[model samples]
Target: MGNQLHASAIRWLSHVPFPTTLVWLPETVGADEEALLLAAPFLGESPDGLSLCRDPLGKPYPARRGYPVPWLHISNTHDGGQRLLLAAKHENLVGVGLDVVHLPRLRSPHKDRAYLHRLAARFMEPTEYERFQCAARQDDEEALRRRVAAHFSLMEAASKALGTGLKVGAFMGHSASLPLSALGALQLEPSVQLFFDDHAQTRLATLNAQRWEAYWGSDDTYLVSAVFLFDNEQINKLPLDEQTPFMSY
Candidate 1:
């Protein structure tokens, strides 16, 4: 149903020992029935007992599963023909959030001028700008550009996971300063592990964050990043791709 890396990623994620199912969906046309598709993978033979419910704000919660899943939270996002679905069991984890964009969507006339500088100033910390400055000085201008895109994408996805979306919650630039190397790594691999900067974890109290990265599928023209809360307080438990779940699938 998916590429080897994607299928492997889901299996790796599902083994987080948190009683969650990470399902991958194929790109489809028009509006997709996201809620239905979230449970479609695990429905197996007995699809009758699985139920999907919504809260006051129309947030989805998986009430029961025909299999053993008791409580589930799903975050669905579709952009530029790419679809990402994230689910976490409510009892083991608080919630899940996701954000993704077509990298080309960032294409704008305001490449790097007063307007772009103004927006960057509003969102990024002064220290963050220093990192960007260092990158810009390099001969690899493409890496510098991709770093900006990857870092901003991480900010957006992290905010969504905090249940704040963009307007009020998209201000990570003020408090968070991710490693430039990590940001660069994301442009090539989606499995990189990223821990929050010192300010974010202790000073800002903004989000309990870790391990958000980018992906470029064989047929995909877009980049992707996702963020999620952990079951326990071990935020930096292990390198994301190497963290073996304490519980079995």
Candidate 2:
């Protein structure tokens, strides 16, 4: 994993407007080690010199010399088995969100297509769900499962960016009564829109007036998703032309 990024990941990360990094590893890395070890490069600290502290909402940020670095943000998720995903970005007004879904579990006998359809219904708009169901009916079970899982991953990732978990308010809906679909219309950065990679399933949107960049990708084992939120200040702080390529992990 020495600085090499998956081709799909490279294409997906290239569209981000700021220096963001993602790390995927075995869950055995140790819970605390997830951030401390992987975050050292971005935080300018050796793993031994870094620690973690959480905000009131329980979001973790790295601490250096025993002082918390509030401006930098980190997030992590475990696959419920043997994998972990972490994301980090060092901007004063930014946050990162991540989620991992085990695809094989979704196909378990008890968690079949109908079960997934029911889960999707809880979050998707009625019309969106109808369309998904219609398409799923004609598609193979695995395709349907992956598409539904992608939508879930994107929403969960957005919630993490918002620091609200999966609450109703994170829906980004027109109203509390109606929420937008995960694949619904969104205001994306022009560069992101032009270079969109279907393989990575990237998406960008605005939530509570903050800029949210959401992305997802998968292998046979699991689907990983991440989001980066640039608060209003960070959003306006940099001009598009001045933004640089993503940082190395």
Candidate 3:
């Protein structure tokens, strides 16, 4: 079941409208081990030359021989050390973030109907919760559960893409707030765009400006969400000077 779900996630992720690659690694694996895994013939031959590193904000990026690989962007998420969800894109993409959660795990063993709603409160704003309530009222118990799962994955995915992992200020800040308010309105259909607010645009102006979009899907077991920070004008082009021959999903 776990292998099937993992394959399903990779297959679903391949359809994302960007040049991206994804792989799964053990959650507790170190950078050297991760580099070696990625260095398999499918990716490249330079095992010793590949590794991972973090920036000042702790965003991981692909590196080579201890030096940052300028053309690779990477982001990762996991569900409590069960497995690592690693996503990579070329420098042509500003950023890429991914998150996955197990849906069955969300159901409280005690059968608490309001479990999802209550859990959302920890991260959702008041207005967001209000909108969720309005939409959730029309959903059956199962649908309501999926919506709540999507809620968690989408928000966390977007936060990771922004290089801030669920920080309070990333969702609602004085200078630049993500368009988190837009998420509340989503029906969690198949995929949707989560626009950034004016503050975000102004702040990201230097990266030739960007727009955020999230794509999500689920199986009976796992829900996966991916966030991309891409150029608004070109969508898949970045200002990097070099490129890497990384494999894609």
Candidate 4:
């Protein structure tokens, strides 16, 4: 497969060629299982591939037949909390990761500082921390919320691309910066890159590096998903248009 990114929700596909495909689901779409069932056929896999299910806590559920490709699953958070799921095929050598969260409308009180700080320390880069600090100093609630959302989302994307789920602890080690360029320089494990766009209603982040690409989208209904090719080097050798085995599918 070749390395590229596509907007699954767009009417016109991008010209960039890559072996990977990104599927974005609206709030109306079902959870991971349902989304996978709909997406499997497009990748030339059977509906049974969606049978395997796992909870956000990483507990494995039943699957009809194990998938032959890597998959990253994401869903939005409700009033309680959110869930992220991942699955992959060892035989075919593919891996996937995913994450999701609801965008915060208001900043929490200082009483919630401990929790937020811990999360920031875990997933934010130094530049991101600076930006957050600056936003906090100005008492800009909206800016703070957006930065936090962007930081977490990017980390989530990186985690998925690395195929570590959240098992790895480096996520909290990074932060967001004022100038977006600072983001490209952060040294993250798995050598991932973070991309984001934040507005009043939504915050989206994606990580693309080498043969892998991971993404996170948060709003009233948020989601994250990632796709990775088995042979990392093979993707670079092929042209973008001719990239994945699924092109014909």
RMSD of each: 8.1, 7.8, 5.8, 11.1
- lDDT score of residue 205 within candidate 2: 28
| Candidate 3, lDDT over the whole model | 0.59
Q: Higher-lDDT candidate among 1 and 4?
A: 1
Q: How accurate is candidate 1 locally (lDDT)?
A: 0.45
Clashing pairs in 2: none
lDDT (Cα atoms) of all candidates against the true structure: 0.45, 0.56, 0.59, 0.38
lDDT of 3 by residue, 72-92 (tens): 566766673445534444445
lDDT of 4 by residue, 148-200 (tens): 55456555544443333343344432222122222221322233344322420
> Residue 14's C-alpha lDDT in candidate 3?
48
Q: How do all models score by TM-score? A: 0.56, 0.67, 0.73, 0.46
32, model 4: CA deviation in Å?
3.0
Root-mean-square deviation of candidate 3 = 5.8
Of 1 and 2, the candidate ranking higher by TM-score: 2
Residue 213 accuracy (lDDT) in model 1: 29
Q: State model 2's lDDT.
A: 0.56
Please say which candidate is ahead in lDDT: 2 or 4: 2
Q: State the number of backbone clashes in model 2.
A: 0
